[model samples]
Target: MRTLFFRSASPSPSNSPSRSTIPTSSPRHSFSDSLMEENIEMAQTLITKWDNSDVSSYTKLTSLFHDDRREAKEYLKCVRDLQSAMHHFVNSQDSSAEKLIISQNLMQSAMKRLEKEFYQILSENRENLDSETVSSRSSESRASTRSSVSDLESESEDELMVLDADQVSSIPMADLKSIADCMISAGYGKECVKIYKIIRKSIVDEGLYHLGVEKMSLSQVQKMDWNVLETKIKNWVNAVKVAVKTIFYGERLLCDHVFSSSDSIRESCFSEISKEAATTLFGFPELVAKCKKSPEKMFRTLDLYQAVADLWPEIESIFSFESTFAVRSLGVNSLIKLGEAVRGMLEDFESAIQKDQSKTPVPAGGIHPLTRYVMNYITFLTDYTEILADIFADYPLTLQTPLPEAYFGCYDVDESPISVRIAWLVLVLLCKLDGKAELYKDVALSYLFLANNLQYVVAKVRDSNLKYLLGDYWVGKHESKVQQYAGNYERMGWSKVYASLPENPTAEISSDQAKAYFKQFNAAFEEAYKKQSSWVVTDPKLRDELKVLVAKKVVPAYREFYEKHRVGLRRECGVDSLVRYAPENLNNYLSDLLYGASGGGSVSSSFSTTSSSHSRGR
Candidate 1:
């Protein structure tokens, strides 16, 4: 209060940038030297402390430079100078004292700062300094660039023009030979690709071959010398490209320890290289048109194939998702051609084998040589069984055919071995017979293999029926047998097995266990029956065959049930009792009498005559 002087305290910072005339925009480097120097000093101190295992007193001591910009800048300048000196000390030839004085941490700090500045500059100026921007700058700059480029281009054209007949033919060949030697020596695949491109371009656009033919007789060369040479050169270039691309692409850098460094470097190279190659080779407007119009014709050219063949490894390596798909479409066409060739060769071989077989007789030993050969062939065929089964699993809906036709398709004895044919027929009967034929019958072939004995055949048939029935296929023809099996199954106390099936036949079944098997078999039959041409007539001839089986199974069973329980069943299921009972007792009693009296369930009721009539008679 002596002078009544006071200093106003600074307000606390708010969210918004405060307005001031203090040039708070910052000197940019007001804190720069201090910030960098302090950061590096702190980092170095921490690193030294870490290296020394001094963890007790490592709290940041960076506050001194934070508040005083002037002092901070001065300190930072000194630190930066120290950092630069350390870098120079490490890099310089004078080793003993400088090496001892400069630490790895100080060198690292300098590198970090240098790298940060470089990246910042690059990021900020990338678009401004790019090729397109540089090309379109001020008219003076553009004109100067154009003048320089034009002059170089003209010089190149003049050089091209000066090439005589001998020179044109000899130059490229000589250059290729030298490059090939260099490539073989250095194993520089990228350089090889570049050389090939130059050669190809010379042959195509520069009329190198026309010059080559100047001294030769016109008749010795093709009418269009440049075009023919271009085609050949293109093929060669493509082959090299493919090889290089495969080397770069197919081998994963991380996985292949031998090629890790090279692969990593090549991957970076390929990213930029492949984009240029794709645009040049396939994405060019003319090439795109060709692809769209007739891809097979365009890609199938020998030149293209040659190019691809040479660089298959590189092509494989560089192939991305979109690229692979495009390439494979081309490959598929090639495979089709190859397949046709292979098919022809196979037919010839098969013919020869058949002729040889016809000439030879069966051996007299315990095993015929032909029999062994046939067994081998059978085994070979069996190998495909797994493949076919896999196909069926993957594409169950593919099995669309009538049951009989499907049976024929399965057995196909005319084209298969007797054993295989027999096996197939068993499968067909097991899968499709509908269980209509009586046990131990002629059509059922109940005596064949494991198909004998009513109990055995019925069990086998029961197993088959259960599999298909739950698939939502009716198995209507085998319904009675299924019912019979159900009765037997219940009597045997197979509650779990019975429960595995739909509890009510009329009700829908839902079981995860049966889903896959059910889906396949049902799909097969549905596809078969849904065909319009299956029966070939309004009244199919097989109708009677099916009905006969049904009648044999149903009629006798119905007759026996009626004969044994007619009186009792009539009494229980009489129309008056059915109507009198209405919805409750009627359905229950009628079902019991109808199915239970037939012995699907236990029945306690028996016929009873009136007691009044007996008393009257006595």
Candidate 2:
């Protein structure tokens, strides 16, 4: 019934007052008739003016009347007075009822006109707000122009100030906050997010936000003032925090209601919300890249990430009402990405250092910087590994299906467990070190470099927490490699001594022949021994092993030949006899051949013999 009454109250042109309905004649020219005529004329005029006016002018006129309640009341009173006059005139005995009805129609038309004007003013106000909102969004400003009609009236002066300050493009924080709060209250959280993105872009465009320093060279970053850089980062972070907080406020209401009774539906809602939140907080990778560009920044960022990770569980607990899987996974993915990035940087650093080291001469008995750097980095990995495990503690550990081929040609799918990837990375560094060792011109030096570095690596691994990750088999394999390097060094140095010994000496071989062969052996041994003994074999155990290796090769062979030839050999030159030295003397010399001798010395220290023919006479 109420709906029908409102529908009937709306006036069409036919139902409205017309001049034809007014009487051609009246009984008296009374005051009521004159007053009614004047009120109707005023109402019609106002309606005509309102119809001719545009939305902006109408809005302004409406504001004026609305602000002054007494004036609005006076307009309403005139319409009522006309209605009362028409009713009294109709009841008079001589009055024309048609004239009274026309006056009543005029009063109704005026009331409808007022209602139409008020409705139009509201429509125009809404349209203007929409236009300004669209314009603000396009300009990428956090300052929104949309407001309630009351807010519009109150903030009009401030709006003028904003327009005057537009030339400066500095939006007041209060204004931004007001706009953001309005958006959040109206459930237009996405618009609130747009405000944040616009502000962020503005900051970036103004060169206030630093991103992706990884592309810059280390020298460039190093040249920057530390204090200035620190301030810049602090400002950037604070701005991000503020923007993120705004977005959070906008999302809080929606997030609270996202839960569903069905598990799958709830999960889907959670996924979407998380995706939105992640999009809002999407600058982590760039921040990580900036840290990667410098070691100091990298460590600092790592510490920051660790702090965040540590705080994550508490954050998750607080937001447990909302599904946290997506957010938790995001943090996990970030840590993994950072871990991989740090690994990559270390690999690159290792390669570069090795290349530099290879181009320089090996320092005598000193550890290479590359070695120290690698070991220290490995220690860092141990800590990082723990952090990763902690962050991913609830994560599924089911192994991913192995690819048909290994990822890098070095890592076998079956052997490459995720926990052991760091170990594999260390193995790669060691392999590179070995390749660098081969760059030495002297074969002995190459072997020595390998032995020293490999031994150091094995020792450090044995002593550090890396042992658990690499395992006993890995340790054993490297230890064997160290032994092999020592053996090779000894073989290459003693091959000349071995070559000097005749492969076969006949039973009838003459003393002169033996003398020539022995002379060759003495010269070869002296040359090799003198050169090699001064060479470094710093490890006591390796040095002793190498000495024993030389003795085993030279002493037995020389002793077998001397014992076989001694019966028929004539002692022509006593001290320089063909079979000059006893087996014990040869053994002693060979013991000190590589690492024990001070420098080049006599070829026969214990080989003196008398030049008497006593053996033949006897």
Candidate 3:
């Protein structure tokens, strides 16, 4: 039988078959037992040879038992061989120098026999496991056998090292180095490593090897070839880089996939993936660069920004709050500023030019606020150069200045008085406060001054508008009706003044000044409203138009107050703060102020000559 032949060919032949040898008898489960017996016997022979420092023989014996077996025969063979080798070394006195040389020659003969058996088994195993489906399993089994051979070689190598250390401890450095180089070139890495380590330890113990290793390890030129070391380092970096990139892109794709799935399931999947990202890849610079490079594309592709908004807060607490916030907050701010500025400019220009009144006009870009935010985010990096440089090392190109994009698009606004005034305010703010110039105090002062001037302009306009509405009642109006009312109260006795008015004086006050000023303003408005009926009704169409205008104005008062509060309300009373106080009254005031003129006065024809002067005043 073929099995019997393989068993006979193996060293330390057993009364059975090898695993790779085909059985000539009827196939039966007992065949596995035969293979196991043969493998175990071969393992013992290989171990004996390995312990005796017969490396060539050890390698030969290892080849025999290295094949896949359903019964784990090959694995058992390897294990048994290691055990036998360990036992042989522990029991043998052949290690003594007087007996070592003679026994070593005998050990080599036994190893040569074992090597012949191993090669027969390995070659047969390789031939048998040559199927594609079995390739991986076959390769693994081969690797295990190779590793066992390596182990045997290591044992022989250790014996040599023990012999060398005893004999060459007093040898010159040059001889020791030559031995190292010889081992390295011979592909005896284990032997080389063991010997090198011992040599290093002995030299260090006596302090002789320091300069040599230093010259090798620390020398700038790396006297020995280091391409292997360099290749290994580069390969490691590339592998990690590839893994990181894959995860980043994969995470976004998964988020997108989950988003399109059922909402609850998607949310759960997204949350899990996001948490994983935080743990695994957050702060990886390469990923950050990729995301930043195509921020709009990145976000739009998977709505990653929105997903981050939903998930990052929870993740950030465990990761790094400041880092996450610094990136996202600046992004959000840039977007908000860009959107507001562009929208304000376009709308203001459109209104000024009556472009919206035309049949067709260009539409403003409808990119999401966050897209624009990303577009403008680089500025923040440049503006906070030191802080950013500490994190990123260099400023990104997107963040640089000089407005790479132009603002050449046309806008049509009539440049009316209101338009001119608003444009001036915007220009002032831009010139003063917008950018993060280091001149903080100067910028603050400039902003304060602009705010003060704006407040003054609004106040003068309001006063003039009120004067026109109050007619003769305000002809000699020296103070606010509230101040005037306070004076009247002082002139009268407190009790009399209190008695003359309603007990509670239920009057709405502006938020700017609570109860006292409100009562006075209420009284003034009531008086003006009562006198308003007497104004000429010449503009009947204007009255109807005013009715619609008044409604529209009051409806937006709530929104205006909200916006003003968000912006930080100015102290002076103007439409900005007025809406917060007596919204209805302010609405009425605006109506009467725009449409109702006190019957006491009208613009003379000469008023027309000064229209340009009023325009210049704006």
The per-prediction CA RMSD against the true structure, in angstroms, equals: 31.5, 19.8, 27.1
Distance from true location, Cα of 609 in model 3, Å: 48
Question: lDDT by residue for model 1 over 74-157, one digit each (tens)?
Answer: 433443455554455445453336333444445343333322322232234333322223222344543353234233333443
**Whole-model lDDT for model 3 versus the true structure?**
0.31
TM-score of each: 0.21, 0.42, 0.19
Pairs with steric clashes in candidate 3: 60-115, 64-118, 335-373, 352-413, 352-414, 353-412, 353-413, 353-414
Candidate 2 lowest-lDDT run of ten: 602-611
What value does the lDDT take at residue 361 in candidate 3?
Answer: 11
- Alpha-carbon shift of residue 5 in model 2 (angstroms): 56
Could you tell which candidate, 1 or 3, scores higher by TM-score?
1
Clashes of 1: 16
**Model 2 regions lying over 4 Å from their true place:** 1-289, 295-301, 315-344, 350-357, 361-369, 388-420, 504-508, 562-571, 574-618
Best by lDDT: 2
